[model samples]
Target: MSSATRRPNTNCIHSGTRIDPAVGGVNTPIHMSSAYLQPNPQAPETCYPRYMNIPTQQAPADKIAALEHGEAGLVLATGLAAITIPILAMMRPGAHAVFQADLYGGTHHFILAEMERLGLAYTLVPETDPEAIAAAVRPGTTLVHLESPTNPTLKIIDLAATARAVKETNPDAVLCIDNTFATPMNQNPLDLGFDVVMHSGTKYLSGHSDLNCGAVVTSAARMKAIRETAVNIGTSLAPFDSYLLERSMKTLAVRMERHNANALAVAEYLERHPKIGAVHYPGLPSHPGHAAAARQMRGFGGMVSFELGDSPEAARAAVQRLSVIASAISLGGVESTITFPAETSHYKMTREERLAIGVTDTLARLSVGIEDVADLLEDLEGALAAL
Candidate 1:
């Protein structure tokens, strides 16, 4: 079947492959070569690793393009590399962009620290609705970047409306979304009219917490620009990791099903607990963004953020009490983890800055894993009771 018609699970394993003519291997072989045969020595990067044209790299990238329904895609060594390269490529000096206020701390910090030094300008839209995003667009805006089911807060953006917001406000501006929290199985931003979709493959895409990778998928024209920037910057995914990324993605759909189910169960339980003040989960109707999230996403995703007591100390103590869910920084692994946003992802943001976007000290993000629901619930109950 064509990639477009293939079911998601089938596409995960087969979308990027061609029948092997060499050894009939089921998987893409890692090409460790630093060199490739150059009939015209001038084009030395025709099939080089750094250029992201090697078979191992292309296979997974092609898989992402197929899964995301984008014309092209690229994988890189780290999520930051995938995200920063495209933003930098699109917004040169004097250009401006509008960013969603609640973003991955790394991305948010990059804009704050580098935009001025790089001679670019940006506006942060506090509200996630399409109207608010479009209102922030400057006259010379070259990009509008946002995340749906936003980090730490779980605020959902209307992808279709947001894409329209960018097109109507600044036809020239590119709309990019960080789809890490909403993996490809749950949402495909490109189909919603987004210009580009990027992900921290270190999270959901890797699933196992073993690999650190990233991806950017967009139209062929836009990808050419981003790929050129990546080639120069040399952040392309190495062959071995590229191989691992593809291998890992084969079970993405399977894992996400469990993630979605467990997260909703956890969110429901948390919402009922007297110790938890608020539960931020799109799967729950109580969430302010539930309607928007339901309209845009196939699944509400595995992440659930909730209030733990009223202080950072209480949040820290609660995480420490969890014997099963390890306290960790990065998330989206097979093993469950709980961490305070104030201490990890958004720690760099000042208390004032963090609170401005609803990332309070009492907020703790639970990355619900594929563990048995009963066991996970017992662990959480123990933690909350301790707290």
Candidate 2:
């Protein structure tokens, strides 16, 4: 059967596998050669690692593009590079962009600190409402950026509504979404009219936290532009790292299933705990964005954020007391990890800036792993008791 007709789980395992023509090997071999031998002087440029369209890199890129339902993809060295390069390519001098207020701290800093230097104008919308986004657009607006189940806050934006509003307001604008939290297993922004979808392959895509990689999925034309920028900036993924990412894609569907079940279980437990304040998980009925999430996503993702009722100090103490979950900065690994976003991910922002986006000092974000749900509950309960 064609890849388009196969189930997602089937696609995860077999989407981009290419048999070795020479040895008939089941796995695609990593071509570590820096340069391919030129057949003749008149031939086109030969394959090189930095070009990143070689077999090894293209294998994983192909899988990700299939998962996102895009025509093409490019792999980068890091998540920030994946996001930044695309912005640089799409928004030229004198261009304007509309961005969500609550964004990954690194992305927020880059836009506010660098856009002016690049001669680009931007506005951050405090709310994700379609009308608010429509109001922020300018005649020169070239990009509309969004993050659903937003970092640490789990705020779900209405993608279809936002895309419609932005496109109607500015026909030339391109809608880009950061699909790190939801993953292609749970959501595909392209299906909802988004122009591009990006992922931090370091997190869920690798699923083991051993590799750092990023990917952008979009039309062939957009990818060609981004690839040109990536080549000029020297931000291509390494050959070995691309091989690892390809191996990880084989289990993405199964891993995400476990992550979804584990996260929902943990969210329910936290919601009932007396020490917890608000649990920001779209799977929960209490979440403000639950209904919209249900409509757009196949499953609520593995990420959950919550607040302690006491103080920031109490929140830190609980993190220290946890026995099973590690106190870590990143997320989406097979091992459960938690972090105080106010101190880590959002630390660069001022206290007022963090709170303005709902990342309070007392809030903690958890990246649920594919572990036993009972053990996770016991570990969390022990930490809360310590607080």
Candidate 3:
């Protein structure tokens, strides 16, 4: 049967596996040899790890493609590399691109810092609205990049509408989405007309924080270009890391279910709490993007951002008092993590720039884990009480 007919959970487990005929093993074996002996010079060569696309690495790439409903995919060494590879591949000298201003800080920094050096021009749209994005597209625009349930501020964009608008403006322009905040279990941007979907597999895809990997899913033709670009940049995921990513994806569906439940519970609790000045979660009806998110997503996702009623100092104190959640950077693991965007992720941005994007000093970002709802709530409440 075709992968399209299989359920997500089934696809997660079997999408990429190629049983070894020699041992009849169900799992794909890791081919650790960097070099393979070639018997024929005329035939296409599969004589090197980077050039061959070995089974272990290909397995997870196939699984990610299946999950995102894309034609093909490439796994990379890191999420940042995943983002950079695609953008670099699609852009060239004098090419123009449009991007959301509230993008993940790293991406924002990359574009701002490298555009001139790369000989590309770009426009940063201040809002996630499709019309605003379309308006920013110039005649030279070659790409349109978007993020939904935006970082540190859960702003959801209308993917279909935006894709339509971008394509209308420049039919050949590529539309890319950073799908890290909303895992494939929660949202599938490719189905909504996006040309490319990127993920920080270090997050929910791995479930455990032990692996560092990134993924890009797109049409077969686009995948070919991306794979070539990745190989040249030396960003291809290692065979061992790919094996781990494949194993972790087997439980993606179950883990995301728990993440959804735990995050919704946490968001609701914070919304009702007296000390929270504001709560930004698509699951919350009061959130500006709730309706759009409901229309496009299966779940509202695990991330939640909220502000302390008092000040940035109070937010820092609350995070310091937390016992269950770790005070650290990076997110989307089995363990909950909290970080102040002003101090970590978006610290590089000026105060004015951060405020322009609604990332206030008091805002705290949360990657709610699969922990028990009661325990998570108690931990958060205790922290708030201390504030």
Q: TM-score, each model?
A: 0.97, 0.98, 0.97
Better of 1 and 2 by TM-score: 2
Instruction: Summarize candidate 3's per-residue lDDT along 1-387 as a digit string, tens digits.
Output: 778999999999999887899899888898898877767867785655675288888899999999999999888888888898899998988788999999899898899888767768899999888989999987888889888989989899999899998888888889999999999999999999999999889988997889889999999988888888888878878888988999999999999999999999999999999878889999999998899999999999899999875877777888888899999888999999998898888988889999999999888899999989899999998889977
Candidate 2 lDDT, 1-387, residue by residue in tens: 866788898888777777688898888798898878888878776788888868999989988988888899888999888898899899887788889989999889898788867768899999978889888997899898889989989999989988888889898899999999999999999999899898889999999989999999999989999988999999999999999999998999999999999999999999999878989999999998999999999989999999975887778888899889999989999999999998888888998889999999889999999989999999998889866
Q: Candidate 2: minimum summed lDDT over ten consecutive residues — where?
A: 10-19
Query: By descending lDDT, how would the candidates be arranged?
Result: 2, 3, 1
Clashes of each: 0, 0, 0
Q: Which stretches of candidate 2 lie over 4 Å from their true place?
A: none
Best model number under lDDT: 2
lDDT on C-alpha atoms for all candidate structures? 0.89, 0.90, 0.89
Clashes in candidate 3: how many? 0
For model 1, residues 96-189, the per-residue Cα lDDT tens digits are 8889888999998998898867878899888887999999886799999889889989988888988887789888888899999999999999
In model 1, which range of ten residues has the least summed lDDT?
Answer: 15-24
Highest TM-score scorer: 2
